[model samples]
Target: MKLPGIKGFDEEALKKYFKNTGMLLIGKVGSLAIKMLSSIAVANYLLSYGNGILTTSVSYVFLFAALAGLGLDQFIVKELHQYPEKREQILGTAFSLKSFAGLICIPLIYVAWLIYPLEGIKYSHIFLLSFMGIFQSFTIIDSYFQSEVKSKYIMQVQIIGNLVSAAIKVGLILMHSSITFFFIAYLFDTILLSAGYIITYNRKGRSIFNWKYDFSLAKKLLTLSWPLIISGIMVSIYMRVDQIMLKQILGDKGIKEAGAYNTVVMFSEALNFVPIAIVSSLFPAILNARRDDKVRYQKRLQNLYDLMVWLSLSFAIFITIASPIIYKLYKPEYISAAPVLSVHVWGSTFVFLGVASGQYLIAENFGHLSFIRTGLGAIINIVLNILLIPTMGMMGTAIATVSAYFASAFFILFIPKLRQQGIMMLKSLFLVTAFQKIFKR
Candidate 1:
């Protein structure tokens, strides 16, 4: 049962397939540019300490959001593809579960606030941000759209929401609003995005709440999602712990410095949309290939890996060279962040590879293994931060991040099957380039 437009089965069709993929990439890049501009405005207006508080609060919210939804986003996406006819049911189950969890999270957040009283206004921001999880759960419907490769609508929604948010933030800053306005802007942006998704789904005559509750579906989703929950939590730890630890180790001043560094750090992260958008577009194709033909499945995976490596490497080099200039352009306060960004941006290359590999694991239903690997990396990150941050400060955090990413990428390549896959990836690199030359001729 071949999918409607898979090209590997027909070598002559490869050019068309690649062309379409390039188009998708262009759209994704456009959307990412808008997002990057929005982020820059927020960063510039907030400065370092203000941005640190905002960053820390958002990180904490993400941690709780990952836990509250229990990884249902991934679970629903994977399961829905298997039963496209039951897209509504799958989304309904995911939506119901996530909504309940979101409700439950409110109380839990209050309790967490009590436990960590120092969070103060940060706690309120995290609680407000939790809606992003509930809003994210609505993405089950978007997954349905993605499974069919209808990405334009979702892309447009994202671009519009971001533009609106950016406009509001800029307006607020020009009016000399408080830092708290930034959080309010974020909340408003998410609400508008969620509404857009919901309205789109409704117009398509689909509802995430259409199916009745099914205990069996709930159990299955939980079984699949629990490991993801652990993995997501650990990923949060690795990604956020540096900031949290910086706060603890460096106090308020350190937090501000870390935040300044992160401003530069996130500019590198802007390149992340390329790999992410590609992976998202490619997953269903990969899954379908896996189901239909193992040889082609492996071949496609190899091609994907090769492309990822090239893209990641190019971006890393460009950012490394451009970091100092970028930091100066942003503000003089961020000049100290140039060295930190150079080291940290290189980590993005490895992190992109790790993300690509993790997608393979997810497509293969090996989420638990993915979790274990990331968990190990997270542990390494925590230990390094503790030992290095006090003595080396922000530079230490940058070093630890790159080190952790390298360790994780290394571990992924060590899996027996992945080792063989890695070799295929290398071979595919030569073949893809050779084929491109032939096509040009």
Candidate 2:
């Protein structure tokens, strides 16, 4: 099937990428539907208070889990493309680094908890989920498939994983398991996915056992990825800290409030997979354009920005309109999330743009700037959450989130090297680029 033309991009490359991206999107769309239904069911069963506990535990681990990832996936894909013969070494080094970091993250999570514990969340819940960082080491297998442009395999794994995960949640609901079992189910999801990655890799005639760690390569990767590590932490902070803060600031009813907020996020953030699928599937093409043609590279980047803007804007508009009806799927207490969803859904337009620009940053080797932008956003989000939540409640948190997303995604406007790219995004965001493309055709 022919994709509608993007005009300036190489037609052949666009077709190839569209096919690859289409596969990922197909898989993600299926998984998104399954996960959303199961997630709402889980939320309805757990109610606001229990979900508050779940959200806090997951968010807390996610902060430290940033350290566990060490920001190696992008570099891993780049390395594998440039040096396919070194695939084993690259995978091995990354897995070793991530596994070690994941181990350290456990203790770090404990220390952070001790210093400033989540008010009503249990250590057991956090402790169980902390292993997710370690299990995530297996995701290096995912980087391998992405480098090969074999997202179909990754998609298969995601669909199967989500299906099984949804089934487990359904089982828990039927058996009327305690909140603790849900925590186990969460951890099991990571474990199951990791196992899936390994099996898929082996089926593709690749053996995880053949991967070899090299200290020198590990050092090189760390040198390149450290900024991203810090940036990942910062990204996590801005993206997730609000829910954490929500529970803390609201006093006696904080957990219930966080629970209601989680419902809104579940609906809003589910669509994030769209950007990830598009960006990941096209990244190698973007990198090739950078190596081969500067003008084409710029045009492709702009086209990507254009696509991100329109797709996210359309979804946000739909969700904003339908949020009230969407919340009808949830328990009555979650009714407040309907309005918050309307506001919070718009943040995704920036998020989509951010995902696309983030790849541009990696391609341009402007890694340090990534953390700087994210750090600024994190600080803004935290301050806004503090100032707004008390008076504005969940609505304040939504405003803060959308504001932070826009600021971080667009802050490159002030950087000399990044200014042009920022302008391209602005044109896309405002539909100037889209209009120009249409008129030119």
Candidate 3:
């Protein structure tokens, strides 16, 4: 049952690992491919700055959506893993909480709309896109499936939605559709994901109609998840607030700067799936290890740590080298994005470690520590952005992002409670132990 390359994994576990990661990898690659093509199309059509309008619109929604989710995606998974018999109540409460959060955040989203440089697009376009999160609230279903390692179903849903969205973008290109429509396509994709998740859930012989809300369950979920919500908000800010700051700092020319950085950031983030897909499949296994076998849990976690570091380090080097070529593939005006890409892409290293560590924190009930680490990153990012943007522009924002990610992922590892995870990350970052293991083997 043992695997050849990946150590410490049995046959069935290894099979499920491949099955889950394979589906997720396929979905992520497909989604990223389509999105890049779409971005290229937008760049050609709208130019970099006008494209900024589109990027900024979606960024707003992302920030708001993070707030709207209440950080229960992982909570639902943890709950389901611990209590499968309570699936109906757990999911029902999750969905209602998400819906309520979404509705409550909409008004705040609207009040802040006019602040964005919408180019020629209407505020209403951004407004409509914001509501996509409410529908997305139903994606609690994905968490349920993820806990069960049935991501193939989720993959099917995502792949279908992405294909349809890509087709719409192609049609938009054929018709020389307004840039506004491209942004609309983005919203449509969100809708499709929700629809697909719901359909897949029904086909699996479940109904939301049977999903009954338990107030007590909801309260527990909320209490357990509040730190995650805060952490999510901080992480969201550290990630997206830069784009907004770019607009504010640059004056009339700001949107273009923001847009250019957006593309580079997107390119950098595309490969993030390497870690995410792997972690998603491995998380349930790690959590179960905590219950059944502590030694196996720590060993497996270490192996994962090594793997994440190696993958992220390799990708960071590759992107730094290819930044110019990657940017030139877009448009001439986008060349400035090359430096941004080089600097920004390095964030992926810490991001990978951070993501992997997040699963462990949840499994070990250190969500509050996770939140504190995230808050430190957010504070650092905001302060750095403010100080650097006026002088360094987009590249400044890139620097801030990288530094923030490092603080969150690596810097706080100096703390005692988190020292073990920090050590694992450092090993992955430096490859000290990973190399030793390889040579010894």
Candidate 4:
């Protein structure tokens, strides 16, 4: 039997499915546009060096935040699907565990600061930024909204919070505030955003906290999350190691250069959020399809690959062409970022493909594949950085990042089937394009 929502098995139903999917894409794009504009403002106000400090600080925060949650986000998303009746218990245990985990992270944050104190800041910024991890732990609630596919709530929360945060940061800069003010604004943003999510949950007639802990469930969560924890660490390393390496090798000045390059590179990341949101919604649907019909499972996976490639290529081309104009509009000093953007935007194609494949693996309860793929990318990134950064500088990092992503993407395609799956994807694309042309004519 076919799954209830799988493909619709007819043109009209399929059209409706695609339309809904497009709506999700449009919502995500709208939110990302707001974020991108705000980011450009921040980049303009903050010089390359200042932007570097901001990016590096956030990277460290993300690393710690991931550690603080101990991979519970992924665990919750995965296991929650299996135990709908235990929703309250599962959410409560995860929340309580994360809160306790956040407390433990306090001392750990201090030690980390002592070990690696960033330049030009007192301990205050460090202290404030430390709360970022704790604040992020509340994101566990996000999975609940996601599972239900009520993405409008998540989008509303993110858009409002981001706008408010951007306004605060921009106002601070206009007032000639110190960099410390920027950091403070960021912390305040997270705190307020977390509160907003909690309030929203409460207003929906759902209690924000059950405050009950189940030791057995917690252990199961931890066991499932272990691989994700490793994957998280690997992802963190790959994402931030370039800046960290630049800082170590070339000092503050080097970081400034790398930061400028990364500003442009990361602009493409806004595009990534759309695909992530789509995949998040589709995951449960795909999982259900896989369980119901084997042939539909293969067809759905193939369709996903086809859709990803089309989207990835279009974005890659647009960004590659627009890089120069985008840099010019941002600021004159940021022109140097164009080449980096060109190289980095192409990386998005690889990233999108890899993520689509990774979702399939996750739906199959093959989370370990995610660990392996990301781990390989991380390893390749580090090795390339060590080898290339001294000689080529920021360009080296850009090259390394692109190379790592491409390797990971190809690995996903290859390890599944050496040649057959590759041919299948190409054939699907060809058929899609030919059909489009025929309809137009």
**Candidate with maximal TM-score:** 2
Candidate 2, 60-169: lDDT as tens digits:
89998779999998899889989999999999999999999999998888999999898777898889998899999999998898888888998899999999999999
Best candidate per lDDT, number?
2
The true-versus-predicted C-alpha distance at residue 269 of model 4, in Å, is 1.2
Clash number for candidate 4: 0
For candidate 4, write residues 146-194 as lDDT tens digits: 6555656766777777778777877887898777878888789889779
- TM of each candidate vs. truth: 0.88, 0.97, 0.94, 0.88
Kindly list the per-residue Cα lDDT of model 1 for residues 308-426, writing each as its tens digit.
76777778889889887786657577688888888888887677677777788877777788778778889999999999999988889888888887777667567786686555544
Cα shift from native, residue 341, model 2 (Å): 0.3
Tens digit of per-residue lDDT, candidate 3, span 1-441: 322226766567878876988888888787778778867776767787778888877777778777799999888987898899999999999999999998887787877665544454467777878887788887899888888888888888877787788788888888988877777788788888898999899999999889989999999999999999999888888888888788877865888898888888888888887887898788777777878999988877887877777777778899999887887677788898898888898898889888888888877788887788899999999999999999999999999999999999875567787788788778767877767666886
Pairs with steric clashes in candidate 2: none
What lDDT does each candidate get? 0.72, 0.89, 0.82, 0.71
Local error of candidate 1 at residue 134 (angstroms): 2.5
List ranges where model 1 is wrong by over 4 Å. 1-27, 117-122, 208-211, 422-441
**Judged by lDDT relative to the true structure, which candidate is superior, 2 or 3?**
2
- Measured with C-alpha atoms, the lDDT of residue 141 in candidate 3 is 90
lDDT of 4: 0.71
